[model samples]
Target: MAPMYDHPGEHAADDPIRLLAVRDTPLSLDEVHRAVGDAAAGGTALFVGTVRNHDGGADVAGLGYSAHPSAEAELRRVAEKVVANRPVRALAAVHRVGELGVGDVAVIVAVSCPHRAEAFDACRMLIDDLKHSVPIWKHQRFSDGTDEWVGAC
Candidate 1:
């Protein structure tokens, strides 16, 4: 194997974190894709989370997302963790909050790396950790007049 730092841009790599935000507005896949663009990256992986029409055998009418004050900070921590462990050339993530209809986008994440596998792995880790650890909660309204809360409290 070659030396780790020998990869293009490895010696002068800018902060791998390209973008991180918790927004009440909508997310844009194009924006995330642009943010993670890097000349040295051989592959870029993106993951988008959308509000589906059903969940757990219930018909979802709509949903609203709320975030704690620490949510953005927690998101950054998760992004930083991914950067520290992966050969990430660039990374971007955004989560949307507030009221949203079915089929709305909830989150967007992208990672760029020197190889396809590395990009895929880092992108997955970034999104999974953000979902599990960030202080963003979802209030899902069902067609049956019931509601459920999901995600970190």
Candidate 2:
């Protein structure tokens, strides 16, 4: 199923998790924090993935991301796993596609929990799992004027 947005105030008082995806655009850390905020949450952890100026030992010029049509479904699955395995009060994952330059935000994940430990653990696991499981590929452009397609890195 496609990712759906919950109407404002529509979720149950106890409902405190969310997930999202978007095309190429900058990610706002404040927006992610707000999305994971809740009266019941005491801790929030966020992860931001950015296009680095270098990869491996090569100087990177830019990158382009492409994903399978089922990317959202895979993302949802990963979010569910996080919620099930940890004391997550709220969770979200967003990834950008298309072309990106150095320093562009590639992915953002936020998690809220009753405590700092769980929030930190769940947030890290979410990013690691997403990178491994999501069918998104990146094309890396090197300063040497060569391009190579790489799996999530």
Clashing pairs in 1: none
Q: What C-alpha lDDT do the candidate models reach, one value each?
A: 0.85, 0.82
Taking all chains together, each candidate's TM-score versus the true structure is 0.90, 0.90
TM-score, candidate 2, is: 0.90
lDDT of 2 by residue, 24-71 (tens): 666677767777886787889999999999988999999999988888
Give the range where candidate 2 is weakest over 10 consecutive residues by summed lDDT. Answer: 1-10
Q: Report the error of model 2 at residue 89, Å.
A: 0.7
lDDT of 1 by residue, 1-153 (tens): 111222224433467877777877777888788878899999999999999999999999999999888888888789889999999999888888899999999999899999999999999999889989999999999999999998762
> Which residue ranges in model 2 land beyond 4 Å of their true spot?
1-3, 6-14
The candidate that achieves the highest lDDT relative to the unseen native structure: 1
Q: How many backbone clashes does candidate 1 have?
A: 0
